[model samples]
Target: MTKTIPNYLRIHRGIDRQDSTNREQSQNLITSFWNSYSDATGWRIDSRASRKNNVLELLPAVTSETPQDHSDEFTPVVGRIAATRLATAASNLTEQVLRTRECLRQREAELASSAAMIGVEHDGKVSADQIEQSLADAMEACKCDAAALYMLDEDTRYLKARSVVGLPIERLENPPRELRGSRGDLEAMVQDVVTIDNMTAGSIDTWNSPEPFAAGICVAIKVDDIPIGTLWLFRETTTEFGSTESAIARLVATNLSLLLRQAPQAEIFDNPQPHQAIQEIAQWQYESLPVGSALAEGWRVDGMIESSESWATGWHHWDVLPDGTLMLAIAEATDPTATGAMHAAVARAALAAHSGYRHTPAQLIQRVSDTLWQTNTGEQLVSMTYAHLDPETGDGIVSSAGSISALISSRYGYRPLISSLSAPLNTSMDSNAANHEFHMLEGETLLAYSKGFATAGADQMTLGGHIRTAMQLEDRSPLAMLRRKLIDLPLTQERGALTLLRT
Candidate 1:
């Protein structure tokens, strides 16, 4: 019998192959173009120049005194204009390249951070024994008679039992539960945790188990905020699950999710290729922050991303909607791996693509969450703040998920803008986000940032104080002042921030 490849494994292989091919083609094209250009110009290119400064050094500097009518030279005026234009273009390109490199470095740091957090070795394999042991521990900790782990199928249409204890595995596998409707498993996934007072009650969907159980509790298994499966525990008595049991169940489920994510990847590759994984992740391009700033009649928006020497995943985006409303968003991923960056990218793209639809801040956030769920990449959690402001009136609405921070700063002082936050995107199937309305008067600024902005052990007040001090410097732009104030802080993690000043 031929061994069949799983759908997910095939998909990963195809993606990896395509990425490799694209990189090779890009390098070849660059080499060919440079060779042809050098031949045409009769300029011997410096092969030893550093990557950082090579682009500028490759172009010959134009001089004002060059002859205008010469077949090979330009007039003084023409030469000056060409030189100025070339300089400007080179400067912009160089800046963009530097920014891209910095972003890549930050993402690498995030991947390392994620690896440490998940406590998984670079070998990629997560053994079945480890998963079984986790389930046994959960059962012992929760004091449940039996437990079952149902993982989502490849298509995410059904939940299939992957591990079982104190129950017949064949019984649970007879018919996998479809992931639709208000079934116990689905409810647990949506609500995070569900408790059944009695298994015989209508609230529990037992699927007619052979062994009768009195009570049960189910907790959603999630990586990042995306639900991947459900963990069920059964009891012989109708004892309600308390906070301790619920917590232990959730913890076990969390560990299982991480292991599950790795198991498939390991099985598909069948080899220890840690370097390849890191390279592929590093080369995976995410959406870059919007270039420069945006300006309206009364509003000026400037954004900055300061990558940490440590782990950081942050992005900020701003665009002018068709109706002249300025849309702004800032997000941070909990895990600093490719999955986390992709989560931020998905949110950013959804926000930009749907801005023309005129969705409110809360609605926009819901759309991003929905996009993330649909993609099914649940390896990381993304916290975001979405806002839209009427430039003419400085009236705006802001909504946040997770704990992303938003503040308003003026001559009075800086204070928090988003008082409450909902669960992060992919955390739940439904949106619990709420929009907060605020008005910005002249000389007031609105600043939104990811957790990366705060150094470890620092409180909100300390972050606020830094912003207030940055605001006091009237001679510089808000973004510039903020960057200068906080860039030197000892950051063990990454930070991203966006600022809008009403002048």
Candidate 2:
């Protein structure tokens, strides 16, 4: 017997008619449906039948006393209701997409504003501590609680906590080793660590003692195949950290990883690249502060700017604040708008967790700044992502702007960092997209890079595919693995640097 749900309840609860009835007697059908498909949840359907007349209306009928108002057109009340519901859902989706896009714009504006502080002259120099404070201000702008930074030792044997925000400055000044051995008591060992909802007990104890954090995520920062370091995040109880929060953290990490290599200073507003001496470039770094501005209520930030001449043709740069948060910025070889649009699309994709997309210079420019890239017709999006990593716990974020294949390379192979695609900056959006994350172990290395590198080849698997393969083949150390896969891979001819850190 095929059981079904009662028509009235099903209609009221938003169940489709197909599952609400069957050939069997109405009661028997419902009973059998429940018995057979109890595990199934309700589904959606479209119908125009009047609830009162169709024997399924859960609410009172509209008063019929009112005379017919419109003569040219007539829409059934049920149809109107359905249309309204659909409109509401669509409106909600649009609002969400716009909100996410607005977030990107705001982040960019913050970076631009900070860049101005560094001056176009490139005469500014910010210290690591100042960078941490700036990052804290930026994180405050984003409503984050606490942020930290971890840098890989030159030997690549261990990752150390270098800076922190929203926590005790003393702790930030002298952060405890983030990684711990299994069976270690995290509660007793960790000073200001907070727990995150996503971590599982088994997974938390997989590597390092007690795990560095009680529940927060630690994003991996990589250049090429080496694990450079990470940014760590935490918040008090009551707020459940979601995928966006984690992604933002990872974005900060990537930025810092790149910046630390160039300017390991404490003050940021004091450097100028004179004449043609190595066309000076500026990178941004950040830390989330405890206090936030009213306009950016609940947010704080600290950032760094550095001068680098590497990849003058393509985009490449990252920065780290004193506390360990990271900031990453890159320029592509494509049109500006396409680059922005591509990044926007990538952000949406990361939010959605769909299969990756490969970008051309044209696509990248279109994605980042729809009007600017279109009007100026410049090639390159100049995108950025801020994130972090924690050696104590193999957890972190990996957000990007037109960047692809940030991954963890293990002895087994390289694993791509996956994220869900939200709504594209302007194109169609997908709210059902699932946000994805990558987990790492002690022997692993974080691999991060700009999109220019991935799309540089012409093999035609799409740049994303080439990078994906490299990440999956996490054999040997990250640098070694990167050299083997990227050096011989028939990717595009463009050049870009890879950042890495290993435990």
Tens-place lDDT per residue, model 2, 1-503, is: 99998644522112122422321122343334433321221112223545453232222222233245742243334454554454446446656855764454334323322232322333233345544764685366446556655554444444454555655433433534534341122321232222344333444344342123334545555555344455555433223555676556555655664554334232332343233422222111112111111111121121111113322334333333344433233333333232343443333223223112443222332444453234343332333333443334545554444333355544455555633223222222211222234455654545444444434452223333443454456333334434445555544433444343433
Pairs that clash in candidate 1: 68-75, 225-426, 452-494, 452-495
| TM-scores for every predicted model | 0.43, 0.25
Question: Model 1: per-residue lDDT, tens digit, 249-343?
Answer: 77887777666666546555775344675455434433345655546776778776655322236677788888888888888777765556666
Q: How accurate is candidate 2 locally (lDDT)?
A: 0.39
- Which 10-residue window in model 2 sums to the lowest lDDT? 284-293
Clashes per candidate, residues 3 or more apart or on different chains = 4, 157
Cα shift from native, residue 319, model 2 (Å):
4.1
Worst 10 residues of 1 by lDDT: 10-19
lDDT of 1 at 135: 77
Query: How far off is residue 154 in model 1, in Å?
Result: 60
Candidate closest to the true structure, highest TM-score: 1
